[model samples]
Target: ALLGQQETNLSDGSQQRVTQLLKTAEPGGLYGAAGDLSDALPYRDRPGGLRAIAQVHDRYILAEQPDGLCLIEQHIAHERVLYERLNDRWQLVPLTTPVVLEGLNEKQLEQFERLGLAPEEFGPNRWAIRQAPEPLRDRDDLPDALLELSLGGNLDTAQVAIACRTAIRNGTPLDLATLQTLLDDWQRTRNPRTCPHGRPICLTLSESSLARFFRRSWVVGKSHGI
Candidate 1:
């Protein structure tokens, strides 16, 4: 099914072509083709077809299509993937650090309590390091990490954001093996499309859609007498 809202300006043919391309393109890879009307389009240098762009505006996944391009909100995809991964990894191996957050107000204490976090056992800004969830390890900066975690109001939101930041920011560069493992783990997740904060991982477009956007058919017809 089409994942997001429809654009108004696009003709029916462009939309259909976009749908078909998205349905067929390989997962986790970008695809592109050069548009014929390179001279007319402002972004003439850009390649055409389905192509995923970097995360923009923290919301949408901008992708170049044959006709034009599209934006898929990132948060939707981010939340789904992060939630699943956290659950899966935690089930296998719980968070090792047992992060101890200090100087919590009554509200913060209550929040952690609601999350079932045992504050008493953590021992005053010194949470014990134990088993870290997958893609995480017992790092030295546990204190700072916990401090950051404590900022959010709710346990679920705090934990999810912390986990995502941790996973993304840990110093160790992921090797090919690790990258593949991560991808594999991510795929196994219930909602591989999004992260914990509800962001889409990627977006797509198609070649035919791009061609129509630049009125290439009209140009060709005029030149060749269609």
Candidate 2:
């Protein structure tokens, strides 16, 4: 049975309002919004085989490839890069100003020490960071990073927390140069398809995929299957 509502209608006023809202809304992840990127593509000989073009919603990077356009989630891509580096070995760096964390229970504190993180309890339910993993030491959100360390016991989880804390967040503004540097680093990583949390770092919209969306003759054929 067709149980769901068959259709819904929007009043003229409602439709107008929706249109205005959409116009103001940021383009979240349109990889090929500029369209037909057969020219000005980069990194044709690079390892990842993607040429970054622009950033959308400050969270995803748009790249051009031979097949079509690619959209890369910025935060997750950086996380995967960091995770692979951390898994290889520990690299600790001292913090200029120690970070403090609160609200952790006994088990959580033990977990940090087990992972070789230097945390000293100050007042009740409070701890101060003496040193941090090299990748995370310079992060602005060091306190939040300490909390991430307490998430699990094994080295893998530790890497996850550190990577999450250090990577760039949404709403960040980056120029073309910075985006290129980021793409270069991402390509250097051994695994670029998925993050440590198993989230997709990149997505591709191939030429055939775009053709199908537009109902082009190249894909649908002149006869339309007769």
Candidate 2: lDDT of 117?
Answer: 72
Q: What are the root-mean-square deviations of the candidates from the true structure over C-alphas?
A: 11.8, 9.4
lDDT of 1 by residue, 1-226 (tens): 1223333446788787986654444332222343122222312333223345443543344555555555444344444556655655453245643654556666655654554544554666444434333433456765565455445566457558656665543233434444334433444556554466543454434346567767788797687755
| Model 2 residue 155 CA deviation in Å | 1.8
Instruction: Evaluate residue 212 in candidate 1 and report its C-alpha lDDT on the 0 to 100 scale.
Output: 74
**CA lDDT for candidate 1:** 0.48
Q: Each model's TM-score, in the order given? A: 0.46, 0.67
lDDT of 2 by residue, 1-226 (tens): 1212211444588886874443332232222454323222223445767778999999889988787787778888888877887888787777888887878787887887887776788898788878888887776767777777787668778878778777777678888887878888887877665688765566666676677778785554565566
Q: Which candidate leads the pack in lDDT?
A: 2
Decoy 2 TM-score against native: 0.67
- Show where candidate 2 strays beyond 4 Å: 1-48, 96-105, 118-128, 218-226
Q: On a 0 to 100 scale, what is the lDDT of residue 204 in model 1?
A: 39
